[model samples]
Target chain A: MASRAAVKTVIMVAAVALAAATGLAGAGARAADADAVRRGEYLFNAAGCLGCHTDEKGGGKPLAGGRALATPFGTFYPPNITPDPEHGIGRWSDADFIRAFREGRAPDGSYLYPAFPYPSYTRMTDRDLLDLKAYLFSREPVAAANRPHDLSMPFSWRFLLAGWQWLYFDTRGPRPDDPAKPPEWNRGRYVVDALGHCGECHTPRTTFGGMEADRYLAGNPKGPNGDKVPNITPQPRFGIGGWTPGDITLLLETGLTPEGDVVGNAMAEVVRNSTSKLTADDRAAVAAYLQSLPPIGPPP
Target chain B: MDSRVVNALAAGSVAAFLYLGFGGLGAAATDGDPAALVKQREQTMKSMGGGLQTIAKFVKGEAGSAADVQAAVAAITEASSKDPAVVFPQGTAIGTADSDAKPELWQNWPKAVEYWNGLKPATAKLTEAANAGDRAQIAQALQGVSKACANCHEDFRQKKQ
Candidate 1:
């Protein structure tokens, strides 16, 4: 009779002390460091992970998977990245996470399907990957069950992914910024090239699924629903070269084109979930970065 | 005269003229070959599509409430496809908008039929929803019909900017 009540009190006090010590309760309100995590948080938001990883269940359960990404390649069921040790990335090592984010290689060295958009991810620098992990790990973990992907047989072979990576692997990381550019512009460039991975759909692909770097951001016919993902590079005719940086920022915030048409396919989802959540200044920064790229006209 | 009687008499006179009024002029005006027959049917549908657009604009403007929407939808339904030949011609699957419908629609006829037939049913639901005086139902029906239009367009019409 004495043991039961005493045990419960001790447990409750222990939990309270742990919560206060770890600062876990206030994680959402607090943006730690505004230094490293700030950069990582910016990278994550730009990458649009919250869009793809979370269907964002009622009241906004981030990283609880239900978002479906379809491309001509195949449907990729993005895994739950919540810090659940069993269903999410809680157990993933820094190396494993870096490999996945930077090289499109999974924790087990299997080539991650391109649906993960590793082509654009290959541009991420080592520092970028590390910071992203810190930001992600610091987040409050929501334990949601992972959904198994419904890929057909040829795609179901996870080991074959190794060979696919060997053919298309690009792990050199993003190129160093042109030294003449301002630091903010360089930061914006780093966000887009490595973490944002904008090219996975916008860039043209070779027969075997490698990015056609020269044709970067040119329109692609085989988009999420076969709706064209129009060129973002500054080609006046077919690309977004004509859009002012403000126009680009507006598109990110509202999913509406500068001309006021809404994006319908995969882009709409990105705008709805991730970009719309960014600060106006961040959206402008991303716009500025994209505007810097050379124009690549629509695919021939 | 009744409308039927007038139409019959007019048809007879036009035929008689085509037969005897001129030489190659009659044949040129009326294609006699099978290939040309299909083209004629599609041309007729296209010719009538303008009427649909005009009526659609009128109905869209008139629709501020549920009852008004029902009447508008009823008008649009008849315009969309009071007759089958308007939407699904034998030769082309260009749908309501274009004349040169592609062959893929017929190649994949079953799925294409699903898309084409859904238009009338969806439009009818819209009319019913409007009559029911439920703004939400009417909106749902409108969206449903629009989706059908997009589906058929994606399948049959050539991509244009």
Candidate 2:
């Protein structure tokens, strides 16, 4: 009886060992893909791709773009960015995807509208972009058809964006983090300026849709959909100057305000989808950086 | 009577008065006056806003009034617990002036109810945190309440007039 039990135990041990060895071999091959997808998921949220890419009215399918972004210029429907070969970016080369984000150029060599936010995204690092592409490619592809923009006359011309790009698009990537600042502050700056692109909506723009660098993050009076984006600068009267760092952090995480006012409209979407997903430390850093900004009044 | 007991009795009466003043608006809402209903909800929201600010002042150490904090939390709990459906019935969205409620609020009634429903838990948490007298917990709970308010307004409330 002892000899029979020993034989059974030996057989079970051998079977387990064989399964582990086989799994290890496959795990090594899949590990890199897994890492890239994880990194991509982080970048996708950080870059706020879902806000514009998803069709909000149609239940917001991930990356199956159809969100109509309204601007003073026109209402532009974001294209399908899913991995579907027919209706999405599946057939495009890595270079094509990179160029679209970095140079605002489509695979067919046509210029994209400024509404796509490539100008701000162009500041992202190459590695980040690559990881983002990997993440996007990993998503379940949906075959949603592309919708065209409703633009007035000349604005519909894709070639015209080239002239717009020449005026506003910076060839240089993001400016390096200030060495004088702490790593946390730098991270906050990177998230705000490069990843979150908070200035895109907060800062007032020039007549031709170029960001007015002088009025950076001071709150745009002529915001999207004609709503006034409130001043976020630390100005005591009009901006968030009176708020504590915790207040800002809470606002980012939960879209709540000291006045018991919840952040509304576009910012609500931002908190729900983008900034809320950030780590607590990262959100705190963002608050710290925002607090440190020179307190400026509303844009003239 | 013991002073603590007296204080409790006074607080309870004040709370009851405040509740009746605001809760009466809820009753007015059902009287078939959409305008009155809108006005009542707006007043309730304003009270919630005031309560939130009062607590924020305490959290920031701008105010050290324990009684104020207690009163604020009580008011917020009261205001938040009211069913937004009762306050924002059909046709309360009329008039192009003053009211910022969107017509889509009625069109998507179930979604509206969901938004209103989300408020209670946050306020309940706030009541616990405030009772505990922990500043950090209170601050966190305050955020919970604020987020709930902001989320609903984002979808249902119209742009400020």
**CA lDDT of each prediction against the hidden true structure:** 0.65, 0.82
Chain B structural similarity (TM-score) per candidate: 0.52, 0.76
The TM-scores of chain A alone, one per candidate, are 0.77, 0.88
TM-score of candidate 1 relative to the true fold: 0.56
Clashing pairs in 1: A124-A194, A234-A241, B94-B101
Each candidate's interface RMSD, rounded to one decimal?
8.6, 2.4
Top lDDT model:
2
Tens digit per residue, CA lDDT, model 1, B96-122: 334445677667778767776777887
Which residues of candidate 1, in runs, are more than 4 Å off?
A1-40, A56-61, A138-143, A279-282, B1-161
lDDT of 2 by residue, B24-88 (tens): 96465556566666677778888888898788878778776767888998998788777676667
Per-prediction share of native contacts kept: 0.00, 0.63
lDDT of 1 by residue, A142-179 (tens): 77787777776677787877777777766676778879
Tens digits of per-residue lDDT for model 2, A90-205: 99898898898889899999998878788788888888888898888888999888888998868877788889899988868767879999999988887887888888898889
